[model samples]
Target: MPHFCRIVKSGIAAPLLAATLLLLPPAAQADHADWHHGLSLIDKLKYAPDFPHYDYVNPEAPKGGDVKLSTTGTFDTFNPVLDKGQPAVGLALVFDTLLKSADDEISTGYGLLAEGVSYPADISSATFRLRQEAKWADGKPVTPEDVVFSLDRSKELDPLYANYYKHVTSAEKTGERDVTFHFDQKNNRELPNILGQLQILPKHWWEGQGPDGKPRDITKTTLEPVMGSGPYKIAAFSAGASVRYELRDDYWGKSLNVNVGQNNFGSISYTFFGDRDVEFEAFRSGNSDYWLENIAARWATGYDFPAVKDGRVKRESLPNPLRATGVMQALVPNMRRAPFNDERVRQALNFTLDFEEMNRTVFYNAYTRVDSYFWNTDLASSGLPQDAELAILEEVKDKVPPEVFTAPYKNPVGGTPQAGRDNLRRAIALLKEAGFELKGNRMVEAKTGKPFSFEILLSSDTLERVALPYAQNLKKIGIDARVRTVDASQYTNRTRAFDYDMTWIVWAQTLSPGNEQLDYWGSRSATEQGSRNYAGIADPGVDALINKVIFAKDRDTLVAATKALDRVLLAHNYVVPLYYKRDMNIAYWDKFSRPAELPTYAIGFPTIWWSKNASPK
Candidate 1:
């Protein structure tokens, strides 16, 4: 779960969980007495109630001109909340949440649509007072009724939101301009903050008929441009090829503190290409204005074009100051599948991955091995569990692997041929202990005499570079590992259905880990379709630990619980840990200008940026 502040991505769903408890501290009780301008999950907010704008933005920055961008896959829907189709990339620009997050803060939200929010110290419920000035794109005032409707509809329509807000029993319009959400539990501090992340929908527009006279359905994907309250509106679109958003002159909240210097582009367009290589060519030819390089090979040596050398283009490797770039991108073996269910077999798979060699050869030594699920963070497990973390792990000591206590988890090293051979030998031993033996050139199960073979499912041709090497390595151990590349749509559907033997899974972590942990590793999500549990992990110990992290009373306990969970996850060997780079590789044509100070957590593109050459109004 990427720490998406306001807008939820098209195919990727957000987080959710349920708990039952009641009791609020004195501090929480006092907070409910008066409405606050913002909410923070852990620390005090950096910005004061009357702060003019975020420090990262230029409040007087000029805004105009058009920007062209690119997306790898196609999109069929403008409706972002639906899970069925690929929603347009810039669809998030059209909506406004009750509260908006500041990029500099880890887990804090300032008032956006709402003027202020309040919750009792007991935290039984949170009440939000909507700003009378806030209006929909259709010019209708945003009401408490619309907020209530949006909450109810989201919980009813999307499984992701359903599970995320399961603890919230009801959302009702308690006053003319105020709406309250009642939670089933107390001390679950993240509830109010997470609720602030909700993208409020216009109840009237959703219930009304479309231009074709058919009733609009929020649950279904549609090509029709919907009404939104944000700065941009849908200008033009082709079903699956492209979409354009034009800034609205009558847009509400354009003068708000949060909106002071953001949404700079007069028009923003995104073109979709089937192949990444072709996309790069388009970018090189100046068809696109910006490109975020994810491929190391391209970043290392692919940007020697004439334009780059002539000063028309700029390439940079900016340091990512937001969150850890240590995402767990790896070969996730589906635990529901045979052989993968065995702990020893999973361990053998991890041993066969020669990341050290791959980093040198394929990645040009530009990456480092990811050792922890919470990699590059203080929350990651280190030398040994102690104090609070040890006490938490002790509760699950009997359930988790014993090595978690005795040793620090480490991936098998293999930079030299001799090291590779040694690692292969160790993998073979583990497989044999799991009741598998090599007969001739094939490895077969000892009891059933079944040959071991599986497909490494890939969504893009680029992944073949990584998968092919691993498959060749597996072949050396007498295991038939086939690499299959499917189209983007098919890959999305199949992965959502958990219909694969092995696939690349990237689980990005946030500094404030909370309910989202359940969606990533909880038992219930393991079997649930459209859930983020890509590996099908259903361990009871993992489930309990996730709960511990969620219901943690303070930041210290949350960190401890998260580290303990990390230790257990690494011991399981559920994934062949891949590699990550610390810096973000970015390249763009020098047509746009941005703030001197970038947001701590994000690039703040399009938003908080403007055209260097803008026409006077």
Candidate 2:
């Protein structure tokens, strides 16, 4: 989510999808179909009657060509646990999950590494059957031992590496190629998505000590590429530089159902660029074959290249369904900080935001305003409040006060800001009562005599442009605020330490949302090294609700707990929800093509990509 604006050197490559291919009508002057045109019919032939539902798994799929692909980031290491970017991309080619998320349905996985996922009816612990097919890049068989080693190391590793495995309680080897995972509880629909994130590593290769003579923390030792079971193994790696993943000619999972016709590219090489403009120029001139444009100006307009007119490059602007529809980017207040500790102050700050002006002027009309936590999607909360949430608010009306909920949450320009103003006025009164006063229009604490001025941090020029408008509005509300622009390197460190007063960022939630709802908004995650609590929240009630949702074994109970938590967060105004943009700006070469019809979920680039010809090596 932090990379929403910052250009990354890694991510899934958008498929070279050919959208809306022509299917000629029959009424063409009593047309006689020519032999050349008849071949097009063969292109749409069904070779397997039983497998008729397969979308892109054409047995006739042409092979033998090396598809050159490029993403924004480099895969500098082979250790799946250590490297987040390139390893994630590379793992897709080499390893297999216990269960495959095939077209939104859970399916029995083919054994490249795993044969099947076993769960008892009560579902407390699940066992994974490893295929004899699984092997390291060096051809050593992958076993249950490797699975156990990886999971154990992940749980014991430093916060940076362990954060991803926060919920996995423990992993154990039950047999040669069989492993069992004991969850803290049962019934998580996200089990499939979580499994997909795992990448099998070679346990034996990493067993030795490092140069320091101490047990190596796999994450920090980035000297070599990781040995994995994926289609490609690390060919070469340059620290903080470039990485090359060469195809494993003897790949174990080559013919698996989930991998069939996937990872077709012979090799993928990723190179990093500190400057996005430089990266865009490389993409235009063929130095870089692929890159996604984040600047709205480039997407709404056209690429400034001769190849576009010559038909060598194709650009498709499609709607993204997987992204968070409600607040992709948000303005979060630091609840741990004083003055902001009060609910009225937080609500007032949310009201003070002028999203309409920001969207139009700053974003160049590239975004839409979002009122609820879920912006444009069906998952976003409607105007109707959840019964439990409303009930909780009713009970707390006396102690913490209920105007925070009674006040109509409105966008200042479209709806009335009375609730916002009333809240702000109350904030002013409370501050005065707390022995603070408006000195020359800026709120100043009487005790410390410190002005209520804070800085907001962001990583991109685009965000800088948008944040300036929000800062100006805060200035009008007697708060002195300024936008702090930092390079990607500095920005990442500051955010990791929760170093800023206020920040603008987003989170990518899973489709079948789970207990991470707790991690994002719960009190326990507030101070963790890698927590998403940008607000520094520590409310016990919010924490209790989050835990309830996380441990809920039934869907209805999970939904009820989550909805209640969402309202509690809304009441606190820990985060000011911004608009979610439906349209995504994607630009690529026309030579790449994909199946005519795209899956509703895979409309974005990576899932739909296929190259018509090889890219420059």
Candidate 3:
């Protein structure tokens, strides 16, 4: 029979447990004492240099305990189609991805449901084979039907998901154990990575609503799907407040070596808070076990906990994986708007902001000033290119000036200033030459009655803290800049729909940057709502160049094409490159630890684990 354990109410450590223990008989009280003391043993292990990578073995590792989790912001939905964070956290234990990047070098899909997937020579089609032993949480066979249902449902539910599924023309079931995906494009370079985001929902549970409830579809069908081939299944959920997932005793993929290190808890419970102060208090008083420090200032100076001084809390700053973004933040210009439509105006805007000052003053000297849109990475250009490469970039040279491309913004007084006051003067002069003038302290186009007044949206706490200094610089240039703050959900909605005038955004232009460049600065992508084209950029030259890069079969050609594209983007000043954070700030309870062999990519959690003596539920 399944063991019956008390459902520990969600929040900070409960005082009721101690009172309940005192009321029990002598033998029961002794057992309760042992359990309480055993749980406290976690503090002893907290001082260990490293935590065990694999700690979820049944019988080998004790089971039937809960792992309480707390995070800021509640979820409105569990569907990944609309939500990115909540569903991802829940799905990490409740659902398995087809392909997962275990480390920097490999992309593995050691069949939880599907054994292996491969691409053909043409690179247009991919074939997947299922592991014979894979089964759903309810002990039913997981077949190709479930995969197709998930794909179709995702696309039908939201168009944003359809954009992600655009490459796959169709998902065809070859046999009971085999399936194939045909892409519309020559290659789906990030196909495996994309697959990791597509979690399978049970067709059986989804066809009809379960007891816990499900989302209503366009057809007015309420679908509740809890069936999935993962380590755990949702036992109970409180809409946005909290969610409880229980470990599946007869999990199909348990024996696989890949499954050993992840999903360590018997039951994983998550509680959400809308405020940072509340979340911090929860962490300080020992409610939340882990915290991913995104705010630099908060990480550097906010905490002076006794636990930290006493070495009971561990803190480490790790690098952010380039997968999230090439650069953390950038100033994007609306190319669709006039004056900014001119190449000179765009280049002038880029020259106006002094990154060096912004880095030192605004960032508290914690960041590296960025030059290229794709910086530091191999995709970025090192020096002047050869004849053929120069020719391609030179074709668009007439529209842009050499000074704009090569020279740094000149200042009247020596030394770099964060706002670059002299650069702002040059920018104003350039706009004036391009039929723009300051009217009542606002930059307006002489030909058109349009004013250069725009809004800048940001979501990061650190960005919010430092954005004022940057805003002041724009004001100095006689530009009307409005800074708007929003939560993660609102931010996602605003950016996804291309509903804002201007914004501070970042895209990690990784090592093998792909042709999705079209999405950010291309004509085709601008027409589509919710496209990554934040500034409504629509350049024909940019589109053609992106196409060339995408089709280039050879690695050298691809590299050269990418460099050429980067130069074009820089010269056009599509995005004003900002600064990159050199340090990664992460803090957690001392009981947790990670391995020494770190990957080049930022660690997102596949490599992290807890010590044996961690708190028991």
Cα lDDT tens digits, model 3, 1-617, are 00001111111111001000001111222112211110010012211112222232222333344556776555655554442333423644677655333333222223345665555445565556667887878778777777777778776665445655666678878767766666787644444335434667667756655465753442332123346788888788776778888878799876665565555556777787776667877887778766766555566677798988898777877654543234425667666655556767766666666666655544566766666656665656546655655665576666433643464332222126434666787878888888888887777878786877777776544465445665676677777778886775677676666666666776545444453465556677787766667767676666766765656555576667777776666655666666666556666776544445454444534223434454442
Off by over 4 Å in 3: 1-72, 82-89, 106-112, 185-197, 212-225, 320-325, 336-345, 387-419, 447-451, 460-462, 596-607, 614-617
- My TM-score estimates for the predictions, one after another, are 0.95, 0.79, 0.78
Error of 3 at 90 (Å): 3.4
Model 1 whole-model lDDT (C-alpha atoms): 0.81
| Model 1 bad stretches (over 4 Å) | 1-32, 321-326
On TM-score, the stronger of 1 and 2 is 1
Least accurate 10 contiguous residues by lDDT in model 2: 33-42
Q: Distance from true position, residue 307, model 3, in Å? A: 1.9
Residue-wise C-alpha lDDT for candidate 1, range 516-601, written one tens digit per residue: 77877889888887777888899988888988998888779989999999999998898988877777778999998888878877
CA RMSD of each candidate after superposition: 3.1, 10.6, 13.4
Residue range 574-594, candidate 2, lDDT tens digits: 776676556655566665555
Candidate 3: clashing pairs of residues = 42-613, 73-273, 321-602, 325-508, 326-508, 357-418
> On a 0 to 1 TM-score scale, where does candidate 1 land against the true structure?
0.95
Clashes of each: 4, 23, 6
